[model samples]
Target: MATIFTRIVEGEIPSYKIAETDQFLSFLDVRPTVEGHTLCIIKREVDYYFDLTDDELAGLTLFSKRVAQALKQVIDCKRIAVAVLGLEVPHTHVHLIPVRSEQDFHLGRSIEVSPERMEEIAAAVRAALEG
Candidate 1:
C-alpha cells in the first residue's frame, strides 16, 4: 500500500507543494508548526528513515536543504530546523520548520491557518524556490 507521502507524490492526495525532483518532494505542512513548516519526503515509500538506501538518503537531505534555503528566503525566522519523526504517518519524511527560539519546535503547538493563507504561503515558497 502507498503511504500518505507517496499518495501526495503520486497526486492521489493533494499537497501544497514547494519543490519536486525525480526522487523527492517538498510541501507545506497543512498543520504547520510555524508559518512556513514544510515536509520533505522521498518519492519512494519507506516506513523508516534509516531504512532508506544511502543514495536515497543523500538525495532526500540534499533536496530538503534546497527547500530549507528557499523557505528561509521568505519566512521571517532565524533558521529552519529539521526533524525526522515518522510516527505520525508510515512514510519516511523530514520536517523543515521555521524556528526563532527553542519553543518553536513544539509540534503540538500548531496554530490554525486559513486555507487562503496556506495558499499564499505555499506560493511564496514556490516563488522563492523558483527565484
Candidate 2:
C-alpha cells in the first residue's frame, strides 16, 4: 500500500497545498503545532531525509525557505522553525512552524488545532504563498 504521504502526492488524498515543484510539495500540517505550521515533503517516498540526493536536499530546503518567507509575510511569528523527525510516516518530511519563543517549536507542548481552525489556517497560508 502507498503511504499516506504518497497518496497526497498522487492526489488520492486532498491537501491544503502551499507550494509545489516537480520534486517537492509544501502544504499546511493538518495537526499543526502553530497556526501556520507547514509540511515540506520530497516527491519521492524516502524513509530518511539524508537518503535524498544532495540536489534534492538542497532544493527541499530552498523551497521550504520560500514557503517560510511567505508564511512570515502573513502569519504572526518571531521566526519560522524547521524540524525533521521521520518517525511518524515512512516518508521524509520537514515540519515548519511559525514560532514565538524557544518553546514555540517545542513539539511536546504544541497546540492542537480544530478542523475549523485548520481550514482557516489553510486559507491564510495558501494566501501567503500567493501574496
Candidate 3:
C-alpha cells in the first residue's frame, strides 16, 4: 500500500505544492503550525527518515535547505525550524516552520488555513523557489 506522502508525490492526492525536483517534493502542510509551515518529503516512500540511504538522506537535507530558504523569503521569521516527528504519518517527512519565538515551534497548536490562503502561500513560496 502506498503511504499518504507517496499519494501526494504521485498526485493521487492534491497538495498545495511549493517546490519539486526529480527526487523530492515540498508543499504546504494542510494543518500548519504557522502560516508558512511546509513539509518536505522524498519521492520514494520510506517508513523511517533514517532508513533512507546516505545519498538519499543528503539529498533530502539539501533539497529541504533550498525549500527553507525560499520559505524564508516569503515568511518573516528569525529562522526556519526543521522538525522530523514521523509519528503523525507513516511516511518520512521534514516540517519546516518559520519561527520567531519558542511558541512558533508548537506542533500541537496547528492553525486552520482556508484553501484560498493555502493557494496564495504556496504560490508565494513557489515563486520564491523559482526566482
Query: Which numbered prediction scores highest in lDDT against the true structure?
Result: 3
User: Candidate 3 clashing pairs?
Assistant: none
Query: For model 3, how does the per-residue alpha-carbon lDDT over 1-131 read when each residue is reduced to its tens digit?
Result: 99888999888999999988999999999999899899999998888999999999999999999999999999999999999989989888999999999899999988889999999989999889889
List candidate 2 segments past 4 Å from native.
none
* Candidate 3 Cα deviation (angstroms), residue 5: 0.8
Q: What ranges in model 1 sit over 4 Å off?
A: none
The sequence of per-residue lDDT tens digits that candidate 2 reaches over residues 44-90 is: 98999999999989999998898888888878889999899988888
Candidate 3 residue 119 Cα shift, in angstroms, is 0.8
Model 2: number of backbone collisions: 0
lDDT of the candidates, in the order given: 0.90, 0.86, 0.93
* TM-score head-to-head 1 vs 3, winner: 3
lDDT of 1 by residue, 1-131 (tens): 87878878989999888888888898989889889999999888898999999999999989999999999999999999999999989999999999999899988778888888888888998998889
TM-score of each: 0.95, 0.89, 0.97
TM-score of 1: 0.95
What's the lDDT of the predicted structure labeled candidate 2? 0.86
Give the winner by lDDT: 2 or 3. Answer: 3
Cα displacement (Å) at residue 37, model 2: 1.0
| Best candidate, TM-score | 3
